[model samples]
Target: MKRLLFALTIILALNVALAANVDLDQLDIAKFSLTTDEEKTINFEETEYIITTDSITPSEIKLFFSPNNLVITAKKEKPIEIDLNNDREVDFSLTYLTNLDAVTTIELKKTDLPEDEMDDESSPISDLNPKDQVNDILASIKANLKFLVYAVIVLIVLIIIVKSYKKRANPERLYSKAEALHKEAQEFHKDGDEETAQELYDKAEELREKARDMENSEV
Candidate 1:
């Protein structure tokens, strides 16, 4: 299970990395979001926007989305710096007429920047399309949730008490048989030997069924 989790983590990391690529010429994005005219009028703090564009020229970027449609300069970069880099400073802004509230997505493109102005840390947060990033995070959250389910299964297994010994009335007998079957069934299932494991499971279940019948008959 640990190995599986490690593999999943690696895959998630790789996908995120690939999604954040800033190849502007080809124009792709990790995710996107939008802002309403209501939001456009207000200044937002820590609020995100999704933007979409078919093409981006150095002088101006043409947009064809909903809520707002306008051309904005692409020559300058839009910088919305946050605390993600531990810099504790706001150091980015885009000098374009394109309001995030009016745009559906931000098309990523390749660009050259001087060393002093380049910040790679914000690349992942800014470039990823909003929806895709949300999906990735949700998937990671789901993977983590599996551990909780495993923990609960363990708790229930641990709480199992076996304190009777009257042959057909013994709880220990039933639990022991069950544990043995569970282990074998899992191994067999992993090995893709479902038919044999199912047969064994059926036999173990038959024992349990007989015990249940015995208890019911006595009652």
Candidate 2:
């Protein structure tokens, strides 16, 4: 009875695995647009898409969007609504076949400015009032000041951590000490002091080993 139950479980798992394999060519984007245009831009609150597949059920379909602001799922022929959280235009959408190495991409249309208005070559600064321009400059400086302060703080913290790590395990210092000891050993050997030369060579070897260990630990 136990063997029979195990066989049934394996069959069930295989069936589920087979159901998740979807073909990219079999999937189609039937429709993709905003449900309503409250203004000139596409409405994020009512963005809709209609996806279809030749064999895969809607439950098996998965949807992904970038810059990853929206969380939505695909439904059968029915339209799926998405909230983009802001009025900014969507860049693109991606559809993934779950457990299958298949993907589909859809590029969204960007909001367009009137051609006549965009062709104007006059500088925008010319239209701004002197007082308004000063206020805008001040606001920009204020915003950047906060970011600059945070960046400096982060840099200081990183420098402190790096200095602390080097103090604990300095491979360059170990290597330099090893090289000095090796030179001293060579000089002692040249002077025919065999015992002192051997001792210095042993100390150099130990320092070289410490340097190698420090380098390996970092990796």
Candidate 3:
């Protein structure tokens, strides 16, 4: 069981590593504009997002997701950094579009930095479109495989317990049969029937082995 758990951990780690190596080209680049009092919602197979620009402070952007919410204040020229999966990588960016001191309009876009410019410790978050659908399918299959592994382990353990219980139930009966075979072999040997005596001895040994196994069986 310990070995099984170790193997499972290794497989999980490998899967995570592979998933982290996402292709930037496969991701859909998002670009949109939001004015004061404007709201937009985007839905994907795996995740959903609802965003709005504050009416009073247009630079303040609000993103809605399940169980959590994120709000950011954008600045002119400097893009607002977003790390949705908390991997320290920038997945989305927001920036103010006006030169005036008062905020008015904001633009939402994908991270524009080159892959080489990103931090070495960074990993991209799962965004929308074909990539999101693919991720959802892979996650579903991984969960199913985990369930199957646990089921098979349970079945094997149950079979072992049942077999051990059967062997332990009537060990005395096996020993009695083995003693009878041993006495019969001795009688044949005393009658000068060497070949028959040898065969009988072999049968006696087999019965004795069954008795020993039954006695040693653990449930």
Best by the lDDT measure: 3
Per-model RMSD to reference: 17.8, 19.5, 17.7
TM-score computed on alpha carbons, candidate 3? 0.31
lDDT tens string, model 2, 136-208?
Answer: 4564444335445654565566567667767766888888888999999999999999999999999989988
Better of 1 and 2 by lDDT: 2
lDDT of 2: 0.47
Ranking according to TM-score, highest score first: 3, 2, 1
Q: For candidate 1, lDDT tens digit of each residue in 168-203? A: 466557757876887788789899999988987887
Tally clashing residue pairs in candidate 1. 19
Report the Cα lDDT for candidate 3: 0.54
Could you tell which candidate, 1 or 3, scores higher by TM-score?
3
lDDT (Cα, 0-100) at 132 in candidate 2: 57
